[model samples]
Target: MSDGADTGEAGEPGTEARPGLVRRFLLGLIVVLPMSAALIAGGAFLYGKWRFNAPGPAAAPTVVWLAPGHGLSSIAERLREAHVLDETGIFRLAVELNRAAGALKAGEYEIPAHASMADIVRILREGKSIVHRITVPEGLTSQEAMEIVRADPVLTGDMPPVPAEGSLLPETYNFSRGTTRAQIVQRMQKSASALINEAWPHRTANLPYKTQREAIILASIVEKETGLAAERPKVAAVFVNRLRKPMRLQSDPTIIYGITGGKGPLGRPIRQSELDRVTPYNTYQVDGLPPTPICNPGRASIEAVLNPPETNDLYFVADGTGGHAFASSLADHGRNVARWRQVEKKAVQVPVKAAEERTAGTKPVIPLKAPARHVGG
Candidate 1:
C-alpha cells in the first residue's frame, strides 16, 4: 500500500507541472508577439517619413492647377500624374498623418524641380499660388485700357461698363485666377483717386487750376503732348503759364479729342477745316481748361502738372526729331517755327522729289502755313 501511494504522488506532480509549462509558453507568446508587431509598425512609420521628405521625380518645374472642391485623394492623384510625386498613397498617408486634409486650398501653383512631397503639402496648405500681373501702360484712354483688361485670358467674368475717362489709373495690376473683371476696374479707379488725394496737398502754390479735376485735365494734355520723360515738367509749365496769362492753350490733342471723343487716335493728320471748326474741347477757341480729362494720365504726368518747374515758356513746336522746341517769346517761337518748317520741307522733298523730277522746272508745293500738321502749340 505504501509503494502505491508514493507512485500516485509523483504522478500528481507531473500532471501539475505540465499545465504550468503550457501556461508559460502561452504568456511568452503573448509578450513576444506584440513586441515583434510593434517593431515592424515603428519601422514602417520611419520609412514613410523618409519618403514624404524625399525629392520628387520631376526633372523641371511643374505648374499644377488645383481647382476648388478637390478632395485630398484627387490632389494626390494629380500630383502623381504631374510627376511631382512618386505615388499617391504616400502623399495621402502623409497628408492624413499631418492632419492637413482640410487645410489644403485651391489655386494655381508652380512647383519647383525636385520639390518634396512635404514641400508641396505645405504650399497647398498655405494657399501660396502663382501670381499673375497685367500692365496698362501710361496715357491709354480709359476705353483703350479696358480693352486690354477684357482681352486677358486669365481674368474671368464679363467686364463692367467702361468707367469714366481719366478715372482709371494706368499701371501694372496683380491678380489671381478667377478674379472678376469688375474688381480690376474698381482697383484702377481706386488707385487713381488715391493718387490724386495724395498729390493734391503737395501741389505748387498759386497754380492756375483750382480743383483736382482741372489739374487732371491739364495733366492729360501734358501726357499727350510729349513722350519724353524730361519734357513733362517743362510742358506742364508751358500750359500753366498760358493759363495764367489768360492766353489760349491751342493744344492740338484737345482738338483731336473733341473730334474722336478719346475713342482712338485720329488715323489722319488734322485738316485745316477741323482746326477752325468750333467745339467745346478746341483749346484754340476755348478760354481755359477742357470740360474733362481727355485720357488717363500716369503718375509722372500728374505729378509734373502739380509741381511744374518755374518757367515763362509759352510756345512749343516740333523739332522733327520726335521732340518739341520750347520758346519763351513769340519772336523766338517764330525762329523755332522757321527751323521746323525747314525740317518739314526737307521731309516732304525726300518722298516727293522723284515726282518733282518727273516734271522739269516745277516746284513741289509744300505749304508753309499749316501744311498738314504736327502736334504743337
Candidate 2:
C-alpha cells in the first residue's frame, strides 16, 4: 500500500508541474517579444523624424523663379534638380495635403538650399515672392517709357495705346514678374495725378498757367532743359517770366518732339532751320504753351514750376560747367552767347585728335569754370 501511494503522488505532481511551466514560458514569450519589437520600431520612427527636422547648416544658395504658368509637377521637378528638396514625391504629397496646387503666384522666388518639402509648399501657398525694381528716368516721353516696359522680360500682357504726354510720372517702380505693361502705365498715371494734386495748392502767386496741365507743360520743358537739381527753379523762372511777358517759350525739346512724331529719341542736335518749323509743338512758332507736354516730369520739376524761385532772369546758355549761364538782359545774354561760341570753337578744332585719344583710353581735357553764382548784370 505504501509503495503504491508514493508512485501515484510522484506521477500526479510531475504531470501538473509540466503543464504549469509550459504555460508560464509561453505567456512570458508572447508579452515580452511584442513589447521588445514595439520599442525597436518606435525608436526607428523617432530617429527618422529627428533627422529630417534638424536645423541645417547656413550657407548662401541660389534662388529659382517659378514662373506663372508652371504646374505643380514642373515646379517639383525643378526643385528636385536644384536639390532644394530631397524627395519630389514628399513635396507632391505636401502640396496635395495643403490643397495649394492652384494658389502659387508667378514671381521670382528664393528657395534655400536643402529646404524641406513642407517649407516649400508653405512658401508657395502664402504667395510670397521677390519684387523687381525698374526706374524710369525723368523727361522720357510716353513712347520711350513704353519701350522700356516692353523690353523687360518679366513684364507681360499686350501694351495699350500710349497715353498723352505728361500723364505718367517719372520715378522708381516696384513690380513682380509677369506684371502687365498696361498695369505699369496705370501705376504711373496714378502717381502723376497724386503728385499734381499735392503740389497744386502750394503754387506761387500770379503764375501764368490757367490750369494744372499748363503747369505740367512748363515743368516738362524745365525737365528737358536742365539736369542740375539746383538749376530747375531758375530754369522754370525763365519760362515763367517769358509767359508773363507773353513772349515765345522757345524750348528746343518741344521742337524736336514735333519733328520726331514722338516715335523715338531725337538723334541729332536741333538745327537753326528746324527751329522755324510751323509745328504746334515748336514754341518758337507758337507764342504760348504747347498743346501738351513733350515728356514726363518728376516731382521736383513739377514743384519747381509751381513754386518758381524769386528771380527775374530770362535767358540761359550752357556754361560748359555742367550748368547754365543765366542773364536777365539781352546785352548780358549776348556776351554769354559769345563766350559759349568761343568754347565751341576750341572744342571743334581738335575733334579728330580727341577721337583718337578717346579710342586709346586716354582722359580728354575738359575745361573747368568758376562756381555757379547768381548774375544780375
Candidate 3:
C-alpha cells in the first residue's frame, strides 16, 4: 500500500486489470465474429446446393408448357406449379450459377420423375421439347389433309385456306405444341415444292408432259391407280405409253374427282354415266392429262412418273389381287378383265350393283372390243 496502486493476483479482478480484460474480450469478439459468420455462410451454401441437386416432387413424368416471351422467373413459377419442382429459388440460383439464364426455351416439355433441379434446367436450356407428329397419308386431297391438321388438338390457330391439289407433300410432319395449323400447311407445301424442284432435274428424257405441272398431274393419277408400292412403276408406264399412243387414260379416280371435285371420297363405285360425262377431269372423255391433280401424290408416285421403267404396256385393269393386270394389247386387257370377273364375281357384284342401282337398273356389259369400263376392271 505504499503508493495506493491497485494490486491483485493474476486471476483476481481489480481496476488495473480491467483494461486487460477489455482487450481480451475485444480480441475474442474479433476472432469469433468471423468464424460464426463463416459457419453460417457455409451452412447456407450447402443447403442451397442440396436443394439444387435433390429429386423433384413429380411422381410420374409430367408435361410443362412454357409460353413464348416468358422470363426466367415466370418459367420457374411454371415449373413449381407443374409439380416439377418443390420450389423455384434453388432452380433459379442453379441456372444463374451455370450461366444459362438466357438459354431456356419455350415449348412443351416432358419432365421425368425424380428429376433433379439441375436436370430440369439442363433440359430447358437444351430445348429438349416433346415432339408431336401428324401423318398425312398419300393420295389425300388438300381438303382432307387440312381437315386432319384442323382436327389436331395440340396444334393451335385456325387453318389456312386449302392448298392446291398435289401441292402438299404427304409425310409424317414433326412439330411441338402451340404450332399453328397454317404453319404446318405451309411447311407441307414447301416440302412438296422442294421435292419437285430436286426431282425435276433428274427426270427421264422424252416424258410426254411438257411442264412440271403436267408431271404432277400424271403422278397424281399414278397414285390413285394403285395402292401397291411395287405396282407404281408399271401403272405409270401404262399411262406414259398411252400418252405416247394418244390413247385415253381411262382412269376411274379421274371420273370420281370430276363428280366430287375432290371435296371428299365418292363412297361408292363410279357409275358409267359419271365416266361418260365430258368433265375436264374425266380421263375417259378427256384426250390427255386432266386439268389439275386429282389428289396429292407421294414421293414414290412422283418418282415413278418422272423415271418410269422401260415397258410397252398400254392398258391396265385391276386383277382382283390388290394389283393390276398390265397388257400391251387390247385383246390381253380383255382377257385379264374376263379372268378378274371370274375370280372376283362377288367383288364384281359391288361395283356392278353400284352402277346399276344409280342408273335405273341398267346393267353394264363388259365389251370385248375395249377395256373393261367399270371400277377396278
Candidate 4:
C-alpha cells in the first residue's frame, strides 16, 4: 500500500508544477499589457504634438487663394502635393478635432514662411485674407478701363462688353481675391450715377445746360484738356462763358474725338484737315457741346463744370508753363498766343541743342528764361 501511494503522489507533483507556471505567466501578462499600452499611447501623443507645432515645408512665404467650395480635406491634399505639409491625413484629422472644418472662409491668405499646420488652420478660420486694389485713373474712356479690368488676372468672370463713354466713375476699387470683374463695373456705374444726382441739384444758376447730360458732355472735354486739379474750375468757366455767348465750343479734344471716334489716341498732333472735318462730335464746327462726352470725366471735373469759378474769361492759351493763360479780350489772347509761340520755339530748340552738345562733348546750354509775363507780355 505505501509503494502505490508514492507513485500516485509523484505523478500529481508534476501536475501541481504546471499549474504554478501557468499562474506566473498570466500575472506577467496582466502587469506588462497595461504598461505597453501606456507607452504606445504616450508616443503617439508626442508625435502628434511635434507634427502639429512644426513649421511647414514652404520654401518662402506663400499666398494661397482659397476659392469657394474648397473643403478642409481638399486643401490638405493640395498642401501635401505642394510639399507644404508632410502629413495631410493628420492635418485633416486635426481640423476635425478642432471643429473648424466647416468654418473656413474663402479668400487670398498669406501663409508665413515655415508656418505650422495649426497656424494655417487658424488663419483660414479667422478669415484673414489679403485685400487687392485696382485704381482706374481719371479720364480713361470706358473702353480703356474695360481693358484694365480684363488684364487683371485675379478677377474672374465673363468680361462685359465695352460700356458707353462717361458711364463709369474712375476711382480706386477694393476687393477680396476671387471677386468678379462685372461687379466692379457695376459699382463704378452706380457711384457715378449717385454723384451726378447729388451734384446736379446744386449746379450754378442760369447755366445754358437744361439737363445733367450736357454738363457731363462738357466736363469730359475739360478733363481731357488739363491734368491740373486747381485749373478745372477755371477751364469749366471758360467753356461756360463761351456757351452763354452761344459761340462754338471749339475744343481741340472734340476735334480729336471726331477723327478717332474716341477709340484710342490719335498718336500725332491734330491737322488742319481733321479740325475742319464735320463729324457729329466735332465742336470746332458744331454750334454747341459734342454729341456726348469725349472721355470718362472724373468727379472733380464733373463738379467743376456744375459749379464753375465766377469769371467772364472768354479765351485761354497755353502759357510758357504747362498751365494756360486766360484772356477776356481778343487782343489779350493774341498777345498770349504770341508768347506761347515763343515758348514753343525755345522748347523745340532745347532737346535738339542738348543732343548736339552730347554728340560734340560740349557743356549743355543754360535753360532759357521763361517769359516775364504770358498774358500781358
Stretches of model 4 off by over 4 angstroms after superposition = 1-46, 351-359, 363-377
Compute the lDDT for candidate 3.
0.87
Off by over 4 Å in 3: 1-13, 346-377
Local distance difference test scores for all models: 0.87, 0.79, 0.87, 0.83
Tens-place lDDT digits, model 2, residues 2-31 = 998988777644676888899999999999
**Residue 63 lDDT (model 1):** 95
Task: Name the runs in model 1 displaced over 4 angstroms.
Answer: 1-15, 68-74, 99-105, 125-128, 352-377
Error of 1 at 82 (Å): 3.1
Cα error, candidate 3, residue 20 (Å): 3.5
Q: Could you say which candidate leads in TM-score?
A: 3
What global local distance difference test value does model 1 have?
0.87
Q: List TM-score per model, in order.
A: 0.86, 0.76, 0.88, 0.81
Candidate 4 lDDT by residue in tens digits, 1-377? 99999887787446768878999999999999999999998898778878988888887878886778988877887667666687787788878888888988888888888889888888888997998888889888888889899998888898987888898888999999888999888988898899999999998899989888888898898898777898899888988988999877778777777777767877777777876788877677778898888888999999999999889787887786668899888888898788788887887798789889989999887555433222122
RMSD to the true structure for each prediction, in A, is 4.7, 5.9, 6.3, 4.6
RMSD of 2: 5.9
| Candidate 1 per-residue lDDT over residues 153-221, each given as its tens digit | 998899899889889888999988877899999999999999999999999999999999999999999
